[model samples]
Target: MATALATKPQVSAAEWEARQQLAACYRIFDMLGWSEMIYNHITVKVPDQEGAFLINPFGLHFSEINASNLVKIDIDGNTLDGSPHPVNRAGFVQHALFHRHLPDAHCIMHSHTTAGMAVSSVEGGLQPTNFYACNFAGQIAYHDFEGVTVRDEEGARLLANLGDKRVMLLRNHGILVMGQTLPEAFIKHWALQRACEIQVATASMGTPLLVPDAVVAVHQRDVHMAQVPGGPGSADFAAMVRLVDRIDTSWRE
Candidate 1:
């Protein structure tokens, strides 16, 4: 086990920065209650390193993730530099498919939140019943659940279902989203979580009202233009980063 590989001097500056940012993201997911123990994964591509990515140490809880402890690996899931911790190849089975095929998929996040899973199980996925739901409108994609995503062959099917959409609801599973950068991916998931939460909350309160298609069109346009306008350095992501910093800066190690 090479825990010494976690140090800044052990890797390039770009990789180190990516590690710290990704570790902070893990902490953010834990704080937001999106982590399903160590089940789902949030992976980021190593900057300037073709085909290289970073994923969490398989056995560690999201709350325990730190920059130094993350494992570096390739699209095939082989460790670039031996890690003290083993990497979960199951995560790579799905995530690698996107990072390899989509240029904009720099960071990919998957969450199994209770609300998300509930919404996924229904015939209709994420409805236009709330403001957050309206943001996605008719653009959310859906993929049929084929048990656990541990097979490499399933990667092609998942990508085919994803198409050009940024967000997808895996039927009977959860939510999956990818972005050109880490912050974009995070903000998108934030909206998805809220949409799912509201949908689940309304399910028990009688028939839910749906937004008109015309209004949803306008709403999507406005929300897109207003959200993360500053792109990668968006205040939406920066604000969350600040909060995590206050709660525990250990992820930055």
Candidate 2:
């Protein structure tokens, strides 16, 4: 558990709002059973702060995170605001690479969920066996894991592997999803995990899965075209926010 800070640094209204949304993301992760203890990370770029972002404090469980407790830091992992909690070194290195290199990747989420890790270790990454998997038919990337991501040089390899893709399966490590918004990122992560879960369950039956290439292509096109303002992803995310609000609104603090 992390010790709560006695005070929060003064920040801009936009920064504060981003903090609240990011904190809610943490709680949502906990509610969906996507958190791996205090490991992994979800980071959002501060609205107007160049190269600055917000991440969860190192020791807090996802459920225990709140707006004020999140640590604000630059791309280099230097603390921007005076917070007592230290940032996760590995998390910062991995996340900062994307944030610095990709402009559209405003929100990034990394997970170590059972299904996600299982699929990552498989021979072929993210097979298009179902609708969920098909959504990532040609939009996913893969990176081989080189143990814990502590070395700074690993960032370049990560970027190269993740070229022009929204999702990446870290072989033998985990999964990552990057998006223009927090809701989009969360929705993509949810879809990827579901795809992995379905793949594992079906593979255990030892029956040759039959999803036609044509069908997968059509599904991928449909998913991309349906990505509108009030579409499935955004709508479901809004509903989730309402559910999280009803359960415990402390993350807003």
lDDT of each: 0.87, 0.88
Q: Between which residue pairs do clashes occur in model 2?
A: none
| Reference-based TM-score, model 1 | 0.94
Q: Name the best candidate (by lDDT).
A: 2
Model 2 has a clash total of: 0
Candidate 1 clashes between residue pairs 3 or more apart in a chain or in different chains? none
RMSD of each: 2.0, 1.6
lDDT of 2 by residue, 1-253 (tens): 4675436558899998899889888988899999888889999999989999999899988988889999989999999888889899989999998999899999999999999999999898888887788888888899998989989988888888888888999999888999898888989999999999999898988864767889987776676676667644677677788999999998888
Candidate 1 regions off by >4 Å? 1-9
**Deviation of model 2 at 114, angstroms:** 0.1
**Residue 50, candidate 1: C-alpha displacement in angstroms:** 0.4
lDDT per residue for candidate 1 within 28-68, as digits (tens), equals 99988888877789999999789999998888889988998
**Runs in model 2 with CA error above 4 Å?**
5-8, 224-228
Q: How well does candidate 2 match the true structure, expressed as C-alpha RMSD?
A: 1.6
**TM-score of every model?**
0.94, 0.95
